[model samples]
Target: MNDILIQNTTAFFEKSFGSVPQKVVLSPGRINIIGEHIDYNDGYVLPAAIDKIICFAFEKNDSKKSKIIAIDLNEEFEIDLTQEVKLSKVVWTNYIRGVIKQLQDNGFSFEGFNCVFSSNIPVGSGLSSSAALECGMIYGIKELFNLDIQKLDISLLGQKAEHWVGINCGIMDQFSSVHGLENKVIKLDCNTLEYEYHNADFKDYSLILMDSNVKHSLFTSEYNTRRIECEEGLAIIKAEFPEIKSFRDCSEEQVLNLKNKMSEKVFSRVHFVVKEINRVVKACEALDQGNIEVLGQLLFETHYGLSQEYEVSCEELDMLVNTAKDDDAIIGSRLMGGGFGGCTINLIKKGHENDIKSKFSNLYLDTFGIELKFYDVKISNGTTLL
Candidate 1:
């Protein structure tokens, strides 16, 4: 599948520049299996790179100017590496430009490059397509110029680029996109930058993502607000329990004991973060034991916490979960992203995938007049030079 994408991108690059690209890079989008908003709280998250990816074909040019063709969007742009980099009105270019900016800031110098890229990762579906693009560009540049940058550094540069674009995202997306392994999901401790790969072989079950097809503008502001709430909750907890460093350090009992001292909203936010941290630990155990059913149950519980306690889920997201809960084929379902409106990751019995997808699609359209989009994803390796 990725080979086809690379071939197509290479063809496009050659036709656009009249030369074959010297390097081809494939960077995958990621899915968070169980954790949600906890990444910002320095909590653990279980995420894996999916088969969907952005393919890049590029080669260094003689000039100091860089030219890029976005094959998917039918857009093209050029940048002068010697001059100051500025944000572009074209959103996609900002990601590439941001990567260049971060690389320059890190004291890496190189000539400009001409490239063409295409992606199958669904945009606005909360799959981290931007991270794939940024990481792909960074990795491609590193290979093209023979820069001494490690995989982890590539992930960090991609993250810094996103932050430059004003998204303030965490390392999970970029890390998983660059460090994923086949048939494994990474258990990442966001605070410590430590990770462990856990087997994600769902023997007879398939991983499916059902898109809500609605991305609210409220996601950005609301995400920032959630972070503020968590900080406030942490500050309140820290004042009394000075030993506590983050939500990771707090137990359910300790949080409950501080409930009366904090506002209702803050307390609820703190409760979700602390509880979700524990859920990730248990989910890892379930995966180690090869218990998909228990893992599914943990997914459902995480969704509930995101919806009720974290206040991130919307009516459409809740409706999707409710619909899936009625069917035995779907062992678990939940809204999987920043959560105003996005896809719900489901663990469905292999043979019943189509039936469950059909059922969810019809019911969702009937209820909200919007069709649901489904993606059958596989666990695959992270970004790499092909």
Candidate 2:
């Protein structure tokens, strides 16, 4: 599949630019297994890069302008390296422009270059395709210019670029995109930026994502509102418990005790974060012990919390989880990513992958009248030159 993507991208670049690219980079999309909405609370998250990736083919240009083509979108844009980086009216070009703007903000100058890019990651499916694009472009730029920026810094730059584009995303996506390891899940401390790799050998199970194919309109607004509610709850809690920092440090009992002081909405938001943080720790332990059952249970618990408490899960996502609940071959399934509507990560028995996908696809189409999309994903190394 990767070979096909490479050949197609190379062919596109040669056809578009009239020459082969001098450098090629591959940046992968990511999947968050158990943790959700906790990254912004300075909590822990478990995410891994998947095999689906975005590829960038580039070559330095003699002129002072950078030409970029979005192979998938069949769109093209030009940027003057000498001019100040600004937002593009074209939405897709904004990501690339944001990266250039971020690098410029950090005292790095970019040379004019020609880039052709393509992605296999499904859009709006919670796979972090934007992060892949941002990271791949910056990493390629780092190599093309012989810059000394580290991988971690590149992730940060990518994240900043997203922020510039008005997403207000956490570092998890970019971090996983840059530092992902094959067959491993990264336990990241969102507050301290500390991480440790845990072996994710699913033995006889495979990691798969079922896209709900319905993105709710409330995703962006509700996401910001959730963040605000968390802050409001924290402020009320901090006044009473000076020692408590984030939801990570606050216990369930602590929040329960202060439950009367905050609104139900704020309480639910804080409660989900505190509980989800602990679940991530337990999920990591389950992975380390190779206990797939325990991990599966945790995934179900996470979906419930996100649905009832965090209020991020919609009918399509909940239905996807519910549809697989009775299947013994399916161990764990939950709504992954920022939620309102996206993919649900599932741990399914290896041999039953196709059967489960087929059953779920038919059920989803019957229920929602929307076709479901499935991706049989494996953990893969992060961004790389190919």
Residue 301 lDDT (model 1)? 91
The digit string of per-residue lDDT tens for model 2 on 279-344 reads 999999999999989999999999999999999999999998987778999999999999988899
List, residue by residue over 1-386, the lDDT tens digit for candidate 1: 77788889999988888998899999999999987888889999999999999999989888999999999889999999999999988888999999999999999989989999999999989899999999999999999999999999999999999999989888889999999998999999999999999999897789999999998888999898999999999999999999999889999999999999999999999999999999999999999998999988888998899999999899999999988888899898888978889899999998998888888889999999998999999999999988
Q: What's the C-alpha lDDT at position 276 in model 2?
A: 95
Q: Please report, in order, the local distance difference test score of every candidate based on alpha carbons.
A: 0.92, 0.92
TM-score of each: 0.98, 0.98
For model 1, the stretches where C-alpha displacement exceeds 4 angstroms are none
Model 1 scores a C-alpha lDDT of 0.92
The predictions' CA RMSDs to the true structure, in order, are 0.9, 0.9
